[model samples]
Target: AQSVTQPDIHITVSEGASLELRCNYSYGATPYLFWYVQSPGQGLQLLLKYFSGDTLVQGIKGFEAEFKRSQSSFNLRKPSVHWSDAAEYFCAVGVGRSQGNLIFGKGTKLSVKP
Candidate 1:
């Protein structure tokens, strides 16, 4: 079965500080990996995705992720987080023939200290 695990359940970072969220997955083939951010009372927005080719992929809102096949990980990174960045971050994997639905890891809630 395909699944994703996020080690950290919550994280607190001061504004303008670096941030990193860890994610690991288990899949039979090269799965479609994605990072999404959800704010209060809002739907998730795609941060980044890895389909194939280059491992490091850039994303919106100053976010980036690297797909490590050996480790089965796709970790999200941001050089400097903003106060508005305080939200929930999720790492997901799309497996098999599933088109829109994704298998999401327990989200990591980020708290930005002012």
Candidate 2:
């Protein structure tokens, strides 16, 4: 079984400040990690994904995540955040060779202050 945990329920950051969101996963085999963001009333958008190769993977919207196998963590980072970046971010783990159903964590809502 694969599961993801996002410890932070919410985060508030000033616009232009750096941000980082933590994510942890538990899986029997090597897992596929993804970060998705959703606006107030919109569908989720894939931010980034880590399947293999380089531990660090870049994502859309100036986001990036590093897969730390030692810690079982795939944390998202942004050097500078914009007001538009405010949204609910979810960490998901997908199992199997094929793109399997994802087990998502409780989302971390980001609030941007001007």
Candidate with maximal TM-score: 2
lDDT of 1 by residue, 1-114 (tens): 889999999999999999999999999887899999999999999989999999999999989999999999999999999999999999999876557669999999999999
Q: Write the per-residue lDDT of candidate 2 for residues 48-68, one digit (tens) a residue.
A: 999899999999989999999
Best by lDDT: 2
RMSD of each predicted structure: 1.1, 0.9
Residue 69's lDDT in candidate 1: 94
Query: Which residue pairs clash in candidate 2?
Result: none
Q: Tell me how far the alpha carbon of residue 20 in candidate 2 is from the true structure, in angstroms, after superposition.
A: 0.2
* lDDT, candidates in the order shown: 0.95, 0.96
For model 1 the local lDDT of residue 64 reads 95
Tell me which residue pairs clash in candidate 1: none
